[model samples]
Each structure stands twice: as C-alpha cells, then as structure tokens.
Target chain A: MAQQTNNFSNWISQQIEADTTFTLSDAVRSPSRSRLAEGIFPTRKDEEWRYTPLGQILESSPDMDSRSAVTPEFINKLKDAMPQAHTLVFINGQYSENFSDNQTHLENAGLRISRFSQLNSTQLQMVEETILNAALTDDNIFQHITLGLAQNGLFIELAQNVDTQTTLHIIHISSAQGDTSFTNPVQVVRCGENSHLKMVEQFTSLGQAAVITVPASYIQMDKGAGLVHYKIGIENNETNHVSNTSVRVAESGTYQSHQYLLGSKLTRSNLEVSFTGPDGHAVLRGIYLGDENQHLDMRTYMDHAHPHCSSDQHFRGILNGHARGVFNGMVLVRKDAQKTDAQQTNKNLLLSRDARVDTKPQLEIFADDVKCAHGATIGELDPDALFYLQSRGIGKKDAALMLTRAFAAEISQEIELISLQDYLQDKIAASLNEIVNASI
Target chain B: MLSIKNLQVSVEDKPILKGLNLEVKAGEIHAIMGPNGSGKSTLAHVLSGREGYRVDAGTAYYKGLNLLEMAPEIRAREGMFLAFQYPIEIPGVNNTSFLKKALNEIRKHNGEEELDAIDFLSLIKKQMNLVEMKENLLRRPVNQGFSGGEKKRNEILQMAVLNPTLAILDETDSGLDIDALRIVAGGVNKLRSADNAFVVITHYQRLLDYIVPDFVHVLSDGQIIKSGTKELALELEERGYDWLVDKAETQA
Candidate 1:
C-alpha cells in the first residue's frame, strides 16, 4: 500500500517537472512543492478517504502534450444556460480569450478579472495573502498538488461598495483524446467591504474524454460583503474530478454556495468555511446525483471561531445502478463562539438495490449558549406514494419519474436563478428517465 | 356497468373477502354497509387494483372487460375512480400539476386531444367551484399539510375533474363532520349522471341520508347477506348490525 501511494505522488511530481509552461512564482509554489516531496497519497486506511478509492486516478497517466479541439457551437450550447451572464471559456485549463467576453467593460465597472499570468504585483500579493491566511482544518495532498503545479486560474476582485447586477460565468471544458489528461485550475475571489458579487463556475467535458481534473478555490469576504458562488460539475463518464474550496468570512459578511455534482466516474469535493469575525453567516446547499458505476463523495467542515455566527447546510444525493455516494459533514463551535446556531441535514434516495450511500452528520459544540442540530436519512422512494400516483392514471415509470423529480425539486427550487434552476431540473429529469427505463 | 361473481380475495395469506358478489348498471348507486374487518375496504382495494391482495377464486368485469388483469393506472384510465379513506400526503408534488397530468393521461387514453395549460386551469377552476374547494389548495403539494376535510374535498375535486364512469367511495365519511359530509355529498350529487355509477362503502348509514342509494346491501364476513332499497339502511341504523350478522350466521 505504501509503495502504491509513492507511485501516485511520483506521477504527479513527474508531471510538474515536465511542464515548461508553469507560471506561478516560486514563493507561491515552494510550500506545496516541499509538501509534495514527501511522496505520499491517501490510502483506504485514512479516515478522510476511507470510502473513496483512488485506484482509477492513480493508474491513469495524464498526457500533457495531448489536446482536444472544441467547436464554437459546443461553447454556444453551454452559454445558452445563462445568456445574461458575462461568459469566460477555458479549454484544457487554458483560458481562451477568443471565446470569453471582453473584460474591459468589467474593469471599467470596478470589477478586476485577471488571469494568474496577468496578475500585477499588488494583485499577486493579494492572492498569496489569501492563500496563506485561509483557515482550512482538513487540508489534503490533492489540494497541495493543485497549488504546486497549477498554471491556469483567475483572480477576481470587486472594489468596495461595488455590486454588479450581471453574473460572472466561467466554463471549463476538458477535451483530451489520445491519453488521460490532467488539469488543475485555481480561483481566488476577494470581495471588498460592503460589496456583493455573484459568480458561477461550470466544469464539463467534450464527449467521452478521459481526464482527471483537480481544482481549488479560495474566497475572502470583507466586512459587510456578500458573495454568492455556484459550482456545477457535469463531466463525462470517464472523468475523475477532485476539488478543494476554503472560505473565510469577516464581520457581517455573508457567503452562500450551491454545488450540483451531476456526472463523472469518480468525484470527491472537500469544502471548508470559517468565520473570522462575529455576526458572519454561511449557507451551503448541494446535490450529487450518480448512476451506473459512478462514485461521488462530499465532505464539508464548518468552523465557527467567532460569536454570534450561524451556518446552515442541506445536501441530497440520488444514486441508481451500482453507484455509491458518501456524505461526511462536521460543524464545530469553538469555546469562544457563543450564541452560534448551526444546522446540517443530509438525505439520500437509492433507486436500485445495488446502489449504496454512507452518510455521517456530526456537531461539536463547546459554547453553552449555542444551538446545533444534525440529521441524516437514507431510504428508497415511498411505495405508497408511487401507488397513489399510479392510481391517479400515471403509468408506473412516469410515476417513479414524478416522485424522483419531486425529491430533487425540494432543493433545486431554492436556487435563485430561474434559468439555471430550469436547466438543472431538465437535466435531472433526463438522467432519471434513463435510470427509470433501465430499471423498470 | 360493473359485475362481480364469487370475488374471493386474501391479504398476506389471510382471507379477507370470501365469495363476494355484486352487480350494478348505469345510473345506479349501491351502498355497501358493514362492520369493521368485514372486507369493505378489501373489496374497494381489489377493485382498484392495489397490490398485496391475492385473488383466490373470483372475477370482476367492468363493461364486459376483465378488471382483474389490468394495472391500477390502466383501470384508472378506463374510467374507474376510488376516493381513498385516508388520502396520501405527498410532499413536493404540486396539486395542480398532478391533477393536470392525471387529466391529460386519461384524455390521451381515450383518443382525446390533451388540454393546454390555460384550458386545464379553466376546467380545474370550474371543478373547484363545483366542489367548493379553496383555491389556495391548488398551490400546495398534494394532500401535504391538508386538514382531514380538505383532503376529502380534494378527492372530490379530483373526481369532478377526472369524470369517471364508475366511482367507489371507500369510507369517505369516516372522519368528516356534518358540514363536510353535506358538502362532499352535494359534490357527488352534482356530478351524478345517467352515464355514471357510484358504489358507496361506509360503516354507518348517516352518509346515505344525503346521497340516497338506490340499493343497500349488508356485507357481513365478506359476503352480501342482505339486499334491499335505501330504507334497509334506516332499519340497519336503528337496530345495529349485530342482528343482521346473527341472522346471516343462522342462515349459513
């Protein structure tokens, strides 16, 4: 097992050594480089990765030289999901200026959107400070890998009191044909005081591409600032995706995140949020729907280090065929964090006998005047509900579809974007149609 | 319009309905009154094609077609409706959309063009008025957070919308107050026509006071022991079911 772990680390180290296009400064890369030098990867014995197996990702090689072409029509098809938003496209981790909208307009509006390669000295210093100050309690080796070797990413900064009505949509398309390709994209968002920003990050592939995507994001919210962030993953069946995101909220700041993991052979998402000052709030909602031989894992950590802060999290999973899902969440209230309110809920629905889910919701409260509650449930569709629909003139398959859609609608309806909500609902329905047809 | 002969049924290896027989034509209402565990609900469930019921030896025919061989949805599409005693509370399913889908499915099955959104809303509004149902109920999930009376009214609302040929009321008056019962019975009376039939199943004869039944039958131990006009309900109500049960046992 130790030998296998070394080989996986060595594979990543060799890719970093072979890449000549690496652009980050040595100061930003040295810490991760020293950590990666240990040449260790998580094994099944590790508590953090007990349920997620890294065999497929370790066995495949990421060919850096191979690149797949993407057509304009394909990008347009994705752009239709949010037509009113300003769009940016990335193919194989490299930003495409030809496809992205002009950034001069946004710059004029006091929103600075700069690529990592184009970051000025002050912006680069801000990125380094945000990374250094992140209070992540569950940092892992994959995060170090993305940090050490990433060459493509974005740094978005909004000036004080600048709230834009338009949303920022970033699209990442992984299209690798000859061999398994790897791409790591890091994003950092710095919201100034009294400002608000809405951004969406979408990851999708071109056809059935073999790839491994490792992405990381760091967000910093100043006092009285608000950030609405959305991350959507709809990659192909042969893709393996792992992501890490850390957030820090200051006083009176608000952070809301919605993650929809819809496709991929194997996916593991680790998210951590910490309250840096009192009166901060965070809301997290997500859904992971898997089918066939897919495996999906979601892990979250809420750190309430200040007083008078609150966090609410609700996540749901739907698995069919031989899919496996995992939800491991923890909410921590420090001794000094008085009057903290935290609630966590995770619910899962299994459509087939072979499908499985392992959920663990935990709360650790140290303050005496705190309200913390957590709950987890895993079950199949209600048989009585199915019969009721069938007795009302709906066919068996259609009845199953209706109940399953309703299960997801509870969360999808909470999305503030109507177009995105409808798009996700339609996608969920299409996937459920396949599962119902195959099983029934 | 409906016929049954020796309709014996069992649930989980226990016989619930043994040799039950009934017959009804168009433009008629039959009331099946019995005590608890007398197979009133079993008959209704078996007729509606609910699962977990085994047909030991019997047959049910609707319009000369075998009802036992059809699925629940197929039976529903063929104009058979059953108003549940305890309606299901299905969260997240919108009431209006569910009814619209059911209506469209039945219409499509009968080779009728599906109703558009506007037409469906208009029809549902008219049916809601006929049933005196609150308009707010249409915006909530089906039967979720509904009061007992509201659930019964929703069933009647659905019945009015679907417009079935043969409808079965399975203890629809079990938990209703006097006013709710009157309103429900009034909805049924308004929907009754020469082309439709109703089979009202209740433990008491109070429901029969409003929706007068043309035929009343005593169901004791799963079989029809007595058959008469609506006045039989009045006799059974005054004397109770024990006398009728004793008379049937002596006759056996």
Candidate 2:
C-alpha cells in the first residue's frame, strides 16, 4: 500500500517537471506536493465511497507524458457541436491558444482569460490563496493530485459588475495516442462583485484509448455576483474521471452548477458549496447515465453558514446493464444559520435487473428555525405509466424511451442555456437508445 | 365487429372474469354496467393487453383477428382503444407529442401516410375542442397534474385523434363532474360511425344517459347476467343491481 502511494506522488512529480509548456511558481508547487502527500487514495471502506470500489482503477495508474496539440479536425467537430459559444480548446490538459476563439470580445468585456502557467507572481499568489488553499481537503486525494500535477489550464477572472453575454465554452480532449495517460487539469474562476458569467466545461476523449482524467475547479462568487457553470463528462468508455468542484458564495451571490455524466467506465464527482454571507443562494443540479459496466458516484455538500441563506440540490441517475450508481448529498445549517431554506432530492432509475443504485439525502440542521427537506427514491420505470403509453399504440421500446426521457427531462428542464440543454437532450436520447437496444 | 366467448381471466391466481361473453357490431354503442367487483376493469384491461391478467380459457375475436394473441400496442394498431380508469401522469411527455406519436403509429399500421406536423396540429386542435380541452394542456406532460376532468377529456381527445374502430372506455366518468361528463360523452357521440363501434364500461347509468347505448349489459361476478336496450340502464338504475343479482341467482 505504501509503495502504491509513493508511485502516485512520484508519478505526479515527474509530470510536473516534464511538462514545462505551462509554468508554475514554486510557491504554488511546493504546497500542492505537501498536500498530496497528506492523504492516500480512498477505498470502499471510506463511508462516502462505499458504493464505488476503486481497487481496479487505482491499479491501472496513468502516465502523464508531453502535451499534445489539438487537431483542426477536433476543433471543427467541437464547433459543429456548439457553434454559438466562445470555445476554448485544451488538448491533454494543456491549453491550446491557437484554436481558441472570441478572445478579443471577451477581453473588451472585462474578462481576463489566461493560461494558468502564464500567471505572474501576484496572480499566482492570489490563486494559491483562493483555490489551492481551499481545494485540498483530507478526503479529496484526487483534488490534491489535480492541483499538484496539472500542466496547463484556463484561468478566468471577471471584472466587477461586468456581465459576460456570451458563454465561455471550455473543451478538454484526451488524445487517443495518450493511452493510459493522466490529464489532471485545474481551472480557477473568480467572479467580481455584482458581475455575471456563464461557463461550460466538457471532458471528452478523441480516441478509444483508456485515460484517467482528474480535473478540479474552484469558483469564488463575490457579493451579488451570479455564476452559472456546467461540467459535462462524456469521455471514452474506458476512462475513469474524478472531478472536484469547490465554490464560495458571498452575500446575495448566486452559484449554480449543472453537471451531466454520460460516459466513462468509472466516474466520481465531488461538489462542495459554502455560503460565506447572509441571503446567499446556491442551486446544484446533476443527471448521470451509466450503462454496461459503468460505475458513477457523486457527492454533494452544501453549507449554509449565514442566516437567511437558501440552497437547493437535485440529482437524478439512470443505470442500466451491470451499471451501478451512488448519490450522497448532505445539506448543513449551522446553529446561527436561522431562516435557512434547503431542499435536496435524489432520484434514480434502474433499467436492468442487474443495475443498482444507492441514494442517501442527508440533512443536518442545527438551527431550529430552518426549513430543510430531503428525499431519495430508487426504482424502475413505472409499469403503470409504461402500460398507459403502450395502450396508446406506442411500442414497448418507444414507451420505455419516453419514460426514460421524461425522467431525465426533470434535470434538463432546469438548464438555463438553450444550446447546452439541446446538446444534453441529444446525449440523453442516445444513452436511452443504447439502453433499449441492449435490452433487445 | 367484436365477439367474446367464455373468456376466463385471472389476476395473480384470483379469478376476475369467468365465462364472460359479449358481442358488439359496428355502428352500435354497448354499455357494460355493473356493481363493484363485477370485473368491468379486468375485461377492459384484458382487451387492451395489460400485463397482469391471464386468460385461462376462451378467446376474443376483433375483426377476424385473435385479440388475445396481440400485444397492447398491436391491439391499439388494430384499432382498439381503452380509456384507463386511472389515467397515469407521465411527467415529461407532452400531450401533443404523445398524441401525435399515437396517431402516426396507428396510421402507419393501417398503411396510411403519417400526418405532417401542420396536419397533426390541426387534427389535435379540432379534437381538443371536441373534448373541451384547453390548448395549454397540449404543452404540458401527458395527464401530469391534470384535473380528473382534464385527464378524461385528454383520453377522449386521443380516441378522437386515433379514430379507433373499437373504443373501450373504462370508468371514464368515475371522477368527472356532470359538465365534464357531458363534454366527454359529447365527444364520443360525435365519433360514432357505421364503420366503428363503442364499448363503454361504467358502474352507473348516469354516463349512459348522455352516450345512449344501443345495448346495455350487466356484468355480475365476472359474467354477463343480463342484456337489454337503453331502457335497461334506467331500470337497473331504479331497481338497483340487487334486484338483478337475485333474479340471476334464482335462474342459475
């Protein structure tokens, strides 16, 4: 076990040195290495990871080699998929400056988009203080790995009161040639006071090779700021993804996270949102679809530390074949956090007999005046509803697809961006089609 | 044209329909009314190929096809429709999309060209008016959060859109008010034609008053004990099911 732990750190240290395309100051590097050494990889014995066994994944460690270039063909495919958004392409976790678009317009709008390696000393200090300091926790070894080993990533900062009209689309692609490689990319976002910004992160793989992606994002929303964020992971079927998202919301600030997981052999996403001031609000929504031998696990923690703050968390999962899913959501209201309103709901649909799901919605409210409600449900498609549709000339397969689509639509309906919503709808349909075809 | 002979059905080993027999020709409206536990629902579900019911004996023929041999959707494609007693609320399936798909599936099965979006919208709009369903209901999920009256109306609207040759309405008037009942029956009355038939199953004579049945059959303990014309419904309403139960028992 100790030897395995050493290998993880030694591998990360090697990557950090070999990939110098993006530069990081020693101030940012030394602490991340110490933090990575502070913890070991978690196992099923860990309460939060009980449903997802990671023995096989940790055994197959990935190599972090030289950065790859984003091909024009890949850029064209992404443009065809999402034509309206301002796109930023990343190949093997290294930012591709040549392929990115809409930089001038974004710059004029008071949005500073730079590579993480390009940060000056003062900027690096700010990142070290804001993100690296807060993101490294005891249970999140992957987050430590991401911050410590990542080569190059995007750093976005919005000026105070500036509203970004166009959404910034960040596309992270793992090249097929990078077989058994690690792509640990970290993104830092700071929305200034009363500012507004929307961004989407897409994790995809270009080839059939298996890869391990460890991406971490830290977002800080200033007073009255509003930030809409989406993280979509549709990597290769053999890929294993672990993403960590930590958010801090100031007074009256709004933070919304929309995450959809469709591919990958194993996926674990951790989202933690903390309200620093009163009357802040946060909304976290996720929909995960797993098929074949996929294992999907998502954990969410919402902390209402200030009075009159409100938070809502909802997650739905659809598992088929031999797939398994786990959703553990916790909402906490401190003793002085009175008048806090928090609602959490987790619903899962198991399409095959072998498919399984474990959902736990936990709420710990120390404030007596707070109104918090949480619910969790796991079941197959409603037989009665299926019969109702079948009675109207819809085939059994078509009826099942409709019900599956309906189940997913609950999460999709809350998406604020039409283009992202449309893209997700197609993904949901394709997943449902695969499920139906497999059953037949 | 439909015919059933000695149909025996059971649910989970509990017999619900025993030696049930009935017949209905095209252009005629047949109303099956009876007391509780008379297997009216089971008959409707069995005809529509619901999953649970098992036909232990006998056969049902619809237009020379073995009705029991086909699946639910196949039965629907063969022009058979059943308005559920408890309409399910499918949260995200829009009423318009559900109806359009159903209409197209039926049309495709009949070797007729499927209607385009414009024609489908027009057809559904006309049928929606027939059932007095508001246009907004079309945008909402199928029967989701719909009032009792609205769900029944939606079911009738589907019947109108699909134009089934034989429609079996199972307790469609159970939860409806008098006004909703009138609108639902009015829609059914308009769909009556020489090329199609209706089998309206109910527990009361009230629904029969609007959609005047050409023949009325009283089902008791899974079998039809009596048959008469429209006047029989009124007689049963006045005398109650007990009088007929005693008469049928003494005769048996």
What's model 2's overall lDDT?
0.87
The best candidate in terms of DockQ: 2
Candidate 1: segments with Cα more than 4 A from true spot: A1-7, A19-27
> DockQ, per-model, please?
0.82, 0.89
- Can you write out model 1's per-residue Cα lDDT over A1-440, one digit (the tens) per residue? 24455445678778778866656677778888887877667889888889999988888767756666788999998888788899989889889989999999998787999987888888898998898787467667788889888875699999999888879999999988867888889889999998998898999999686889999999999998999888899999999999999999999999999999999999999999999999999999999999999999999999999999999999999999999999999999999999999999999999999999999897888899999999999999998888889888999999999999999999889889788888888988999999999998
Compose the digit string of candidate 2's lDDT tens values, residues A1-440: 12346555566656656765545666666666686655466766667777877665566657655444557987787666567888998877667778888587788889988876678877776676677545433355787677677666667889899987878889989984654777888888989999999888899987777788888888888999999998898888888898888899999999999999989989999999998899999999999999989999889989888999999888999999999999989898999899999999999999999999988888888999988999999999999998998899999999999999989998999997876788899888998998887794
lDDT of 1 at B150: 96
Docking class of 2: high
Candidate 1 C-alpha lDDT tens digits along B50-112: 999999998899999899999999999999999999899888899999999999999999999
Candidate number achieving the greatest TM-score relative to the actual structure? 1
Binned by DockQ into CAPRI classes (incorrect, acceptable, medium, high), candidate 1 is high
Scanning candidate 2 chain A in windows of ten residues, the lowest lDDT window is: A1-10
